[model samples]
Target: MARFFSRDRHGRRPLPSDGFDRALGIAHRWFLDRVGEVATIQYVTAPADMDWWRKDNTPPLISGGIGSSGQVALTLHRKFIELKYSDDGMLPERLYELLITEWAALTGKDVSEIDPEF
Candidate 1:
């Protein structure tokens, strides 16, 4: 097998030639392999640049997040197959709004009365 270098050497994985869906498939499969279905994925923090060749000798993480505290994470890193931990938290405002709207539509509830959890 040939090696593939990520476009951002010190950051996230390079987009696979097949595109975002394929990349999502890869992440989903990896997530399934570890914790099972219904686990959430998070982009913990942004990656830093340039200093990859620095003295620390650590490969930059793609995203790091959860642990034995009932939380889990799946990460795709600068190098493939590096795993880390993260926490579950409030959804972003846009996502929350979208989910709320979708939830209202799906369940036949008024949008104002739908209080989404997670």
Candidate 2:
């Protein structure tokens, strides 16, 4: 990953500036911290053209907002975080817990309800 960002199109490795190095260091640390929770991670060249088919090539049936596959997917595009779980009703609750913890840390108030800005 370092080589991916460090090298130019001609495979020349330019000396990175202090800020760029620092940003890369932080990203590496963040990735390392969450690597254990991830099942798989892939760096794609064209995400839009990427195949999202299941192994059986059948679309999961949805019933009352939940799918028959019992999978919940969470994606944080800004952080490039994607987490998928095969369960019943645990994924959203887990996300809420994370949001509440982060919100409390950012703002010293304990929020009972949060209106998502996004």
Candidate 3:
């Protein structure tokens, strides 16, 4: 089975600079580090409720959230990232950078780069 990691907060906040939660973050990352060694890590952008069906118009890669445009879900089987935004409040362009940074700290893997579009 695959392992997913997710963090949910209200609105937009700067990446890696989450205030206050940094205290527990240390322990959380440590746990992920160990888990990463034995399992695959699928970092999620938001908490998932397994509600992909919405209005019968949603795509497979997008998940439905309560009053949300939608949340992106990445699967390891994909070779690239396909971003489809419903709103202009797009996901930070630096998301891949954040992923690369976190991947190393949590997995001890030297992920120099990912699919550029990711």
Model 3, stretches more than 4 Å misplaced? Answer: 1-91, 113-118
Instruction: Give me the runs in candidate 1 sitting further than 4 Å from their true place.
Output: 1-21, 42-55, 61-63, 67-69, 78-118
Q: Residues 8-99, candidate 3: write the lDDT tens digits.
A: 45665424543213322443354344434322324344335435534575534321112233232222211112244222122223333333
> Model 1 lDDT vs. the true structure?
0.40
TM-score of each: 0.30, 0.23, 0.21
Clashing pairs in 3: none
TM-score of 2: 0.23
Top TM-score prediction, candidate number: 1
> Model 3, poorest ten-residue lDDT window?
72-81
Best by lDDT: 1
The per-model lDDT (C-alpha) reads: 0.40, 0.34, 0.34
Which residue segments of model 2 deviate by more than 4 Å? 1-88, 110-118
* TM-score, ranked from best to worst: 1, 2, 3
In candidate 2, which residue pairs get closer than 3 Å at backbone N, Cα or C atoms, i.e. clash?
none
Q: Count the clashes in each prediction.
A: 4, 0, 0
Better of 1 and 3 by lDDT: 1
Total backbone collisions, model 2: 0
